[model samples]
Target chain A: MTNPTAAMLVIGDEILSGRTRDANMHHLAGELTKQGVDLKEVRVVSDEADAIVAAVKALSDAYDHVFTSGGIGPTHDDITADCIARAFGVGIDVRDDARALLERHYESTGLELNPARLRMARIPDGARLIDNPVSTAPGFTLGNVHVMAGVPLVFQAMVASVVPTLTGGAPLLSQTLRVNRGEGDIAAVLSQLAADFADLSIGCYPFQVNGAFGANVVVRGTDGGRIDAAVTRLAGELGL
Target chain B: MTNPTAAMLVIGDEILSGRTRDANMHHLAGELTKQGVDLKEVRVVSDEADAIVAAVKALSDAYDHVFTSGGIGPTHDDITADCIARAFGVGIDVRDDARALLERHYESTGLELNPARLRMARIPDGARLIDNPVSTAPGFTLGNVHVMAGVPLVFQAMVASVVPTLTGGAPLLSQTLRVNRGEGDIAAVLSQLAADFADLSIGCYPFQVNGAFGANVVVRGTDGGRIDAAVTRLAGELGL
Candidate 1:
């Protein structure tokens, strides 16, 4: 069976403005790869409601799973939940279950459950809460769309809670052969190898380190034996 | 006048597979912001032809300018130039100008201008070449789409060469105030302040340092005086 495909939507003005270098997308991509999910596309948009709504709807409809990060906080600009609810055509409110979770967390920490903080409890209808072990505010899963916080720590924790529930396919296997030659020098052999092993994905990444040019040829596939055999043939062709 | 909007399409498989973190997006974002161009959206798609073509078409239609990085290399997977041509329904081939530039650079460097390396000279019809000081391979500008290299040094050089040719708007001005309190604690006052400065964009970003929570309130506008006045009022309200 083909691996489940996923898309990530990162919502934030900071990222779009170049004020923040997005760490969540890289983190999520690595994590999803390890879980046998193919992360096909990623989008980073400003914290605009229309943009968020459009991106959420498009990704949700196209991919098996859509994960979003950021804009789920307690400020006026934190409008991700509302936009998501609108995208799914569902009503949203401060649900009792979510409020209870926040209430308990704040009470234990001696913090007030103020209106702004309570806003985090306003989840879309028919959504399951994803636990936030680092902070009290919980993320939610709504119809294959997993909404998570922007903070790296909280986002990582939420991913931990969410990944186990997902049905993953066979993990992608890869092997790399480093050829200390320019990609142009090795292109013909690699191209023929790629055509031979049509099932595997062959990619050549060029690099220049300390004024030395080289290429790392990576072969990826789900089947370990196929990838191993392809790598062997690639190594032989390169005479490495 | 409203600032001209721009979108970035990053094409690569290493980024999607989490083998490499993208540096071009952040670099381009900062440069575009400095040029008074509003970077509205960014999408990272794999090095597949269909994916690149789809992203290029979408971004080109939505924004005033679209910048693409990656896949313009000398390997089989380097299909960005062809995809760009397909996206615009234009004919593409190894242009004389680009080929001449590569030939000169290769001759000077004592390197072979082999078939694979020559593939980098392929460019769409009716496109202007963007100079690459770091490498001989030239990027091209077709319509509003500026396609550049994925390597940071070459990408930066290409951006420097291309940005000056485009018209710019008033530079975006911003002021930030750090309030050493939770975002919820300052939400009401900030919300009112944001309403008062409707001409400016006020965003509150929450942070936690040494177990103490605080928020950074940033006010951005094209007008320096308005941004300054808004920051003064915000400082007064926060008693800072």
Candidate 2:
């Protein structure tokens, strides 16, 4: 069976403004790769409600699962929850379970459960909460879309909580050989090898390191044996 | 007048596979911000021809300009040039000017200009070359899409060559106030300030520093005076 496909939507004005370099996309990509889910596409959009709603609708329809990060805090700009609610055409308000969780967490710290903080407890209709072990403010899974925080640590914690619930295919296996030659010098043989191993994917990533040009030829496939055999042949051909 | 809107398409399996963290997007975002180009959206797709072509067409049609990075090298996997041609329904081949530049660069280094290396010389029909000062392989501009190298240095160089030729609006100005309090504590006043400065975009980015939660409230607009006024008002209300 084909691996389940996934897409990521990153929403933040900080990322779009170049004020923050996004770390969540890279983290999610790696985690999904390990889970045997193919991350086919990733889109970064501003924190505007229209943009978020449009992206959420598109990604939800196109992929088996959609993971979103950012715009889920207790600030004026944190409108992701509302946009998501609108996208699904669902009624949203501060749910009791979520509010109780937040209330309990803040009570221990002697902080008031004010209206602004209560904004985090807003959940779309019929959605289940995704646990946040780092902080009591929980992320939620609405349909196939899993919405999480913009903060890297909290995002990772939520991912850990959500990953175990999803079904996954066989882990993708990869082997790499660093060839001490430019990609041009290695392209012909690499092409032939790729043609020979039709089921495997051969990717050549060239780099200029310490003024020396070379490439890392990576072979990836679900079948470990096939990937190993292909990598061996590739290494022998390149004389690496 | 509205600022020229742009979208970026980053193509590479390395990025999607979590083998590489993308640097070009952040660099381009900052440069475009300084040049007053509104970067509205960014998409990262794997190194597949169909994916690249579809994204290229979509972004190019939607935005004033489209900037693409990666998949332009001389490897078997480098299919960006051919994909761009297909996306625009134009023919592609090794142009004489691009080939001449490559030939001269290789000659100086005593490297043979093989077929694999010559792949870099391929340019789409009716395209103008974007200069690559760091590397001799030229990036090309076809229609509103500017294709650049994946390597950060070369990509930055190409951007420098292209940005000066494009028409830029007034540079976007931003002023920020750091409030040493939780977003919940600051949200009410922040919302009021945002409403007062409806023409300017106001964003609050929450952060945790030294175990204390706070936020950076930023006001951005083309009108420097308006942005400054909004920031001043925000700071006064926040008592910062």
Candidate 3:
């Protein structure tokens, strides 16, 4: 069977404008890897309704699971929930469960909940809510796409709430060997070694140390035995 | 004047596997912002030739500049150069200038340059090489797209070499204020304030502190006066 595939869509102008260096993608990638879900793709787009709808439809169709962060706020640009609803061809209305959650949250704070805040209570039909203990506004899973808040903290909290319920495959196995040599020095042997181990992925990440070149060879695979074999072969090829 | 839009295409499987959290996006975003270039989008695709080609064409047409990271290595999966050439409907050949650079780099290191290592010397017709002082494999700019290596250090070096050549608008100005209050508490007023300020973008980012909810409000714009005014009004509304 093919590995379970997932994609992340970071929808926010804050991220795109360089105002926010996104933590959502890194956090989601790590969490998904631990759960054995293969994160195949990630796209960070501005909070445009058309762009969000198009990306949502395309990614939802391509992957088994799609996680979207950002644009789910009370602000005008927070159109992710509505755009996602439109993508699914479903009607969006303020749901009782969502309103109840928002109401309880506001009741405790002694702040009168305005209609704008109630916008967070809007839910697409046939969607299940993901609890957010950190904030009142809940994230929801509609069809294959999971829509969460733009804020990293809120997004992470919602992800933690949702991840436990997912059925996962075998955990991804990986090994890394740091090499002091430049990538060019190890290019030939590394290519041949990579070709020999077709099942494992060999990635060469170069770094600079004191204005000199260095690289790290990372070998990853679902099977531990295959990953180990690849790493061993790579090390031998490097004459380590 | 319209904001100078830019997009980034990150080509790698290591990122998807969660082994590497990309540092280049944040770096580039911050750099572009200072240069008055708006980084509008970012897409991370695997080292698939077709995917790279398609993304290059799509993003290049849509934005003023397309910055790509990764898949510029000498390994088999490093198909970005060829894919980019194909995307632009051009032919790639080993150029004397690139070959000279590679030859010099190899001679300085006293390493025997194999045929596979020389693959880095291949350049597409009509492309300009972007300097990579850290590594011999130089990135290049073809049309509006700038293709660089995945390695953070080398990628940064290439970006430094190329960014100053591009035309940009006014630098985006931003002011951030942190409030030890939940986003939900200030969601309504923030939304209204955002509507009132047509020029400034008000972004609400929530944070978690010792299991308590808090948020940071960031106001961004090209006009420093407008950003300051929005921030002042927001702070007053929040009673901070």
Model 3 vs truth, CA RMSD: 2.1
Local error of candidate 1 at residue B182 (angstroms): 1.5
Candidate number with the higher lDDT (1 or 2): 1
Backbone clash count for every predicted candidate, in the order shown = 0, 0, 1
**Fnat per predicted structure, each in turn:** 0.72, 0.73, 0.62
Candidate 3 TM-score for chain A: 0.96
Local distance difference test, per candidate? 0.90, 0.90, 0.85
Tens-place lDDT per residue, model 2, B92-173, is 9999999999999999988889999999999999999999988789999999999999989889999999877778887777
Which of the CAPRI classes, incorrect, acceptable, medium or high, describes model 2?
medium
> Relative to the unseen true structure, what is the C-alpha lDDT of residue B41 in candidate 3, on a scale of 0 to 100?
83
Estimated TM-score per prediction?
A: 0.98, 0.98, 0.94
Error of 3 at B56 (Å): 1.3
The residue-by-residue lDDT of candidate 1 on A1-240, one tens digit each, is 999999999998887888779988888888888899999999999989999999999999999999999988888899999999999999999999999998998899787899989999999999999999887798999998999999888899999999767899988778889999988889888889989999999999888788778889999889999999999988888788
Candidate 3 reaches a DockQ of: 0.60
Candidate 2 chain B minimal-lDDT segment of 10 residues: B231-240
Candidate 2 C-alpha error for residue B123, in Å: 0.9
Task: Please state the error at residue B227 of candidate 2 in Å.
Answer: 2.4
Tell me how far the alpha carbon of residue B180 in candidate 1 is from the true structure, in angstroms, after superposition.
2.1
